[model samples]
Target chain A: MNELPMSHHKHNDPLPETVLRVKALESLLVEKGLVDPAALDALIDTYETKVGPRNGARVVARAWADPAYRERLLSDASAAIAELGFSGRQGEDMVVLENTPQVHNMVVCTLCSCYPWPVLGLPPVWYKSAPYRARAVAEPRAVLEEFGCSLPEDVEVRVWDSTAEVRYLVLPMRPRGTDALNQAQLAELVTRDSMIGTALPRSP
Target chain B: MNGAHDLGGMHGFGAISPEPDEPVFHADWERRAFAITLAMGAYGRWNLDMSRYARERMEPAEYLRTSYYEHWIHGLQLLLIEQGLLSAAEIEARMQRIAAETDAGAES
Candidate 1:
């Protein structure tokens, strides 16, 4: 069984433009003579060392290697991801939406920055802002094109609106030539954007 | 709180700036940051574990409000504060001190 941790939710309400709120809180702390800059920096450094992208790569690599697992992943993402010991913490509930020829899928947290962190790691620089949330649903193809990804007109684009409690990840079609590759080699193609459905796996 | 920068499909506003001169964040950084954000949460016990937390934890409005990098940045900040590494006032004092030092150094 996966070790499910607890989260501190229940205070959302559009979050008051998170950046502004954080900045406000930070400034308030600074003004109040509360926070120590050096300590904060050091703490950030510690977390930086402890956290990394390897886990995200692992999820992608695993999906690439096992077909049975892949089917399982598509059916029950939370359990499939956990099979590799990648579950819990920031990631609780998960759903994997595959990109098929008939229908294209894109993931977005229109309300807030909900994402599949276990598989893809963190959200990219653009994935957590107003512009992207509003635009992705409005113009997914054009947005994807900006990321150097474009689907043919024949493919229908379906956007996934991730909400509270349910996070989503994109299981891009595995590239061809990768059949001969090992897990590590396969991981190289699982870019952060690819797992989020912004980019595609490299042409194998 | 959900990390801010996981906006996968929220690009509909579609390149506010003109394409040629639009701001371009490095793809590698995004990958690195995402990885870090997820890992930190994994370590912090903020959710049911790494996989479950990352795959879940989507709040509708807040998720859209935060930029992708902001999510990592926010998560890290939250962790720092939560861990008691630096209090609110201490950080400000350091910022002021640094600014003063920089100003003095530049003048001299």
Candidate 2:
């Protein structure tokens, strides 16, 4: 039952208004017995340690290795993802977009950062940023290029705008020169951005 | 319902600078903000969409200026007030008290 850290207040220099505001809110909520401090810590630890892109990577790798799983994933992503124990809030309705030789899929939450939290942990700052949100839908190719993922002209880029219920996870094509790699090895190559469709998986 | 948070396709926001290796929480406040929001969410007082709409109600200009976690805090405060869990005045008083305590600690 560790308390929320007030570390920022130690220095003489004043902290930002938002910092104090959040601190105040937490204190008030706890004092009123509305929020349990342990619950807060657990939530933080879950995102920071337990859940993350690694979970999504495993799903991607499994789909790549098994055709049946890939079929399941493409057809019913939520069920397929839950088979790996990755299902919760912000991930209730999952859609797995497969990146093939002819098409690339990207995800964005135009309204707010509606990400697949169970699998991806949380959306990256760049994914939630105004520029990325605004430009990804308007200029997918250019946005991909900026992330060092320049696609050829022929590949069709599809951008999925995530709503409150639906979340998207991009299943990037398995990189070439890795036919010998196992599922575990393939999962190692999956980066967060690759799952988000911003960058390609690492080549090994 | 149309707020600055809906940045699907507009102009003038230049260049996406991807930090080489970004930590999940940039600052202690951000971590607390995120956790507190989620923890408070467990009360079942408000659902995900309601909370998001609260954040989306922020002033468009101010919303554009603030960081992600800042928006979370804003939305959290709105929900707290709207749900009758806390008042605006109470939050202000608590913020002032914390500030006074911090000042006292810095001097000691």
- In terms of lDDT, which candidate is strongest? 2
Point out the worst 10-residue segment of candidate 1 chain A by lDDT: A3-12
In candidate 2 the C-alpha lDDT for residue B66 amounts to 70
Q: Which pairs, if any, clash in model 2?
A: none
Worst 10 residues of 1 chain B by lDDT: B16-25
Q: Candidate 2: where is the Cα deviation over 4 Å?
A: A1-15
Model 1, A1-204: lDDT tens digits are 122111112111223333343444444444555454444555455334433345666776887788888889888888888887777644688888887778778888775566765665545435654556667887889778878888899988888888757887777777877778898888887766777777787764
Query: What is the lDDT of every predicted structure here?
Result: 0.59, 0.87
Error of 2 at B13 (Å): 0.4
Q: DockQ (Cα-based) per candidate?
A: 0.14, 0.48
Question: Residue A147 of model 1: what lDDT?
Answer: 81
TM-score of 1: 0.58
Weakest lDDT window of 10 consecutive positions for candidate 2 chain B:
B11-20
Worst 10 residues of 2 chain A by lDDT: A5-14
